[model samples]
Target: MDFLNKLKDITTFVFDVDGVLTDGSVFVSEETGEQTRAFNIKDGYALQLAVKLGYNVCAISGSRSKSAIHRLNSLGITEVFIGARDKTEKFKVYLEERHLKATNVLYMGDDIPDLGVIQMAGLPVCPADAAEEIKAVCEYVSPIPGGRGCARDVIEKVLKVQGKWMNAEAYSW
Candidate 1:
């Protein structure tokens, strides 16, 4: 099996929210000091499809934004973990509790804070605009930057290899 073959082995996809789901920008209101991040619709759709297909889709972020959580939860990700300082802990727990092997996981992240969790994934991935150190360590790096279609890039590759990309099941919903 080749590197691409490894993608077909993935049963779960875990993502970091800040830089992975967004462009790593924080929009804060000066009056109320409220922070918000933009999410990519393509990424959201692919994630929801993954969940609907019975793949474990999860989000782990250090951020505690109500809107972000609401959006991800709306997409059917029940394993969303916000305010996770040590994201690797959540990674391990998800695997253990699900009886999933490390090789069955694909984890995407984009910064120093996500480095440890990335290390724990069988298919460690990063966005094109990720930190240099993170890109250097990732097994696969998307050409698209975060908050764009990085999540879709990985999801497409996996689904295509697994004979599920753009299938009738994907269009049913």
Candidate 2:
């Protein structure tokens, strides 16, 4: 149950967007016929930190958004699944394609839609603001709330546990 021990086992990170990345708010604007969502900058920095540490990162979500794709692309995350109603199934396929085992994957989610994949990952995480059921099932819970640096907290914990935190560029001279 030690944080570092969990990080030693993680090789990949899978994320759920609405609640995990954004603040779980869906803004629909009738005037411009556009849907808008807000993402947490701190959480995004954490994801980037994971990538910098060489962890493979991917996003899996039931909702599709051009904005989400653009943001992820900007972050240099290329593996993404949108409008996936059955996340577990997609996760299986993705793992096979990447030649990664389930035990090497870590997942972060905040809702029922993410339950299946969360249960399937080697390490499952939930933000402090996550649903009760998700919190109960997750292997770890971030101290920070979603859209408030929760992702960064998780990533930092994982890296620290794995002994990679001090090796990150930001920590170097």
Candidate 3:
């Protein structure tokens, strides 16, 4: 399949945080007013493994949630772009800075704001619960929903295709 072929060349993984990672829900603290979002542990493991395997993993979000940023940082993702007004511009800069190519990137998004990068990425994917328009543009749509194992599903597929899954590195972490 075209999607499977694209996965073979994926050197980078770009995800939109709010919907693609957090299920599009935000909980505000009563006293501090700090926002929090829950992320799937399985997804976290896949992300960490991808990072360990030398894949370029990045999170671009329109939200300014500190907790979300912290979670990603703990996963060893150094390229976290929070509060990005225009995701397309940030994505371009990211690729240019790393000397990476668009055809080697797999971008997962769940909404309209993610349209630009999704259109440009070599492989565009979405979760089952993604917006209809976003799903329409995506090359693949995982059956898993966000804040679930959607990330894990896609990441596992890519790693498996590239023979990066089920290796010693994956066994350890």
Least accurate 10 contiguous residues by lDDT in model 3: 164-173
Worst 10 residues of 1 by lDDT: 164-173
Tens-digit lDDT track of model 2 for 29-121: 889878778888767777777777778999998998767888877776888788999999999999999899888888989998888998889
Q: Which of candidates 1 and 3 is the stronger one according to TM-score?
A: 3
Clashes of each: 0, 1, 0
Which of the two candidates, 1 or 3, achieves a greater lDDT against the reference? Answer: 3
Ranking by TM-score: 3, 1, 2
Q: What TM-score does prediction 2 earn?
A: 0.91
Best by lDDT: 3
Steric clash pairs (candidate 1): none
Q: Evaluated with TM-score, which candidate comes out highest?
A: 3
Better of 2 and 3 by lDDT: 3
How does candidate 3 score on lDDT?
Answer: 0.93
**Model 3 TM:** 0.98
| Cα RMSDs, all models | 1.2, 2.1, 0.9
Quote the positional error of residue 118 for candidate 1 in Å.
Answer: 1.4
Q: Per-residue lDDT tens digits of candidate 1, residues 35-143? A: 9889999998899899988898889988887778888989988888998878888788878898998888899999998888888788999999999999999999899
**TM-score, every prediction:** 0.95, 0.91, 0.98
Candidate with the larger TM-score of 2 and 3: 3
Model 1, TM vs. native = 0.95
Stretches off by above 4 angstroms in model 3 are none
Which residue pairs in model 2 clash with each other?
A: 4-161
